[model samples]
Target: MTDEEVTEQVREDAEEQAEDAEAETETEDHLGPTSTKLVAEVATQDANLATELEGHLAQLEADREEARERADELESKLKRKQADFQNYKKRAKKRQEQMKDRATEDLVENLLDVRDNLVRAVEDDHENVESLKEGVEMTLKELDRVFEGENVEAIDPDPGTETDPQRHEVMMQVESDQPEGTVADVYQPGYEMGEKVLRAAQVTVSDGE
Candidate 1:
């Protein structure tokens, strides 16, 4: 080949090499560095997601533990409350029984005094009937005072009063000048405290006049 031909071929080969170098630089810029940065970003995002997930799991566990502790505390309180209620019930029952026993003892003690007075009156050797009557009357007066102090009332209705079934017991029907169904006579007086009737008054209800 001539010199001109060799020089022209060499120039064409140099231009082709330059174009290949530019294409290689563009491919490296688009694929190598950009791809490496995208991969690093994906790895960082994955790590962050893992960290957030661990935090959520830990919080859930802590919440579960707190709930269990609260439940235990409430259970303990419930047990204590139940025990207190049972103890209160027992105390109230015992107190009620004690009050009843005390009331019965007081009543018996008062009745014993009356019994002693009667025994003394009976055992006295005074042969005079008037003296015996006076002793008995005085004893009765003392008993009446005791009854009054103890809030005991005598049920001694008048003979002309209307017979009350609630406070009076009719022994027998009797003919009298009073109205029918009226108290003709009181056989025995009753004693009562408050609204309680110890015994009803014994009376004879009058028939028609």
Candidate 2:
């Protein structure tokens, strides 16, 4: 209402405003640098974490690719080995068949000469019976020679010798002076080549007298 009173009121209000402004300025000065520093530190940490995550992802992708490549390589090697083994088996079988055929051919070729000599002996005319017998004996000798060259042996077991079931066939047991379970006499001669018996010799085993 009075001019002095109004001026005093205005001065008091001005002093309170000045004090509030000073307090606000001090608060801003204290918090500004601290807030800005915190924001910068948080941004730096986020950038570092993002970079580490990217590196981990890249490494995982690389490892996965490497494992896939290794598996593929192993599969390829296995397939190749299987193919090679199959080829080897086929080749070995073919070689065995060829060897067997060649051996048979060689045997047939050797036998042809023996057959020709026998045919000639049969066809030739002889004046005397002795001459015919001689010719036949000569042919038999030639056949024996062929057998010797081919490594074919006669299985004519001697009397009183042991009877072998593998090379000898017992026709009948006959009473003889020879020991029992022994060969009495060879009825028919057999043939053998190397360790293999082509035909078993037919013989009569001795029965104890």
Candidate 3:
């Protein structure tokens, strides 16, 4: 219990307290710096992920743009083909009409000489009656043969037969014992070529009074 012993004990107590405070400060420093570094690294990793997502999104947009362009190109091609087909159809229809016109022209050309000969014989100014009559008859036969070959038929309605306006051009009206609209007499013959009419027959119609 001397003063030296008391002072040594106090020194030992003070040194123990200093050691505890230093240990606590060291722990706080280590934890604070390491946690801050860890937080920064996590933020950097999140930034990298965001950059990758942005790149993927840009790639998707580019792909969509290319797809749209391809679709537009296909639509243009379809329109062009459709336009070409329309033009082709128009040309084909025009060609058919032209061919029909050409055929009609050839037919008229071939009949011109026969028509002229008939005209010459019909003038009635020549003195030779018998030869002119024979020439006229021969020309008529040639015309009939031509008409027959072309499927032209003469309409000759019989007495008391039903009259039709399609084949007969009424020339006269007669009062008779026959039924209404009956053909009484046919004055001129009508000619037909297939389903088409070349001429209408002149006829007299009879109606019961």
Write down the TM-score of every candidate. 0.60, 0.67, 0.59
Candidate 3 structure, TM-score to reference: 0.59
Is candidate 1 or 3 superior in TM-score?
Answer: 1
lDDT of 3: 0.87
| Index of the highest-lDDT prediction | 2
After superposition of all CA atoms, the RMSD between model 3 and the true structure is 7.4
lDDT of 1 by residue, 1-209 (tens): 99999999999999999999999999988899888999999999999999999999999999999999999999999999999999999999999999999988887787777778788899988789998898788788878877887789999999779988889999998998878899999999987899998999999988976
Ranking by lDDT: 2, 1, 3
Per-residue CA lDDT of model 3 for 55-119, tens digit only, reads 99999999999999999999999999999999999999999999999978867775776798798
Looking at candidate 2, the ten consecutive residues that score lowest on lDDT are 110-119
**Number of the top-ranking candidate, with TM-score as the measure:** 2
Q: What is the TM-score of candidate 2?
A: 0.67
List, residue by residue over 1-209, the lDDT tens digit for candidate 2. Answer: 89999999999999999999999999999999999999999999999999999999999999999999999999999999999999999999999999999988887787787688778778988888898888788778877887897799999999999989999999999999999989999999999999999999999999968
lDDT score for candidate 1 against the true structure: 0.91
Identify the runs in model 2 with alpha carbons over 4 angstroms from their true place: 1-64
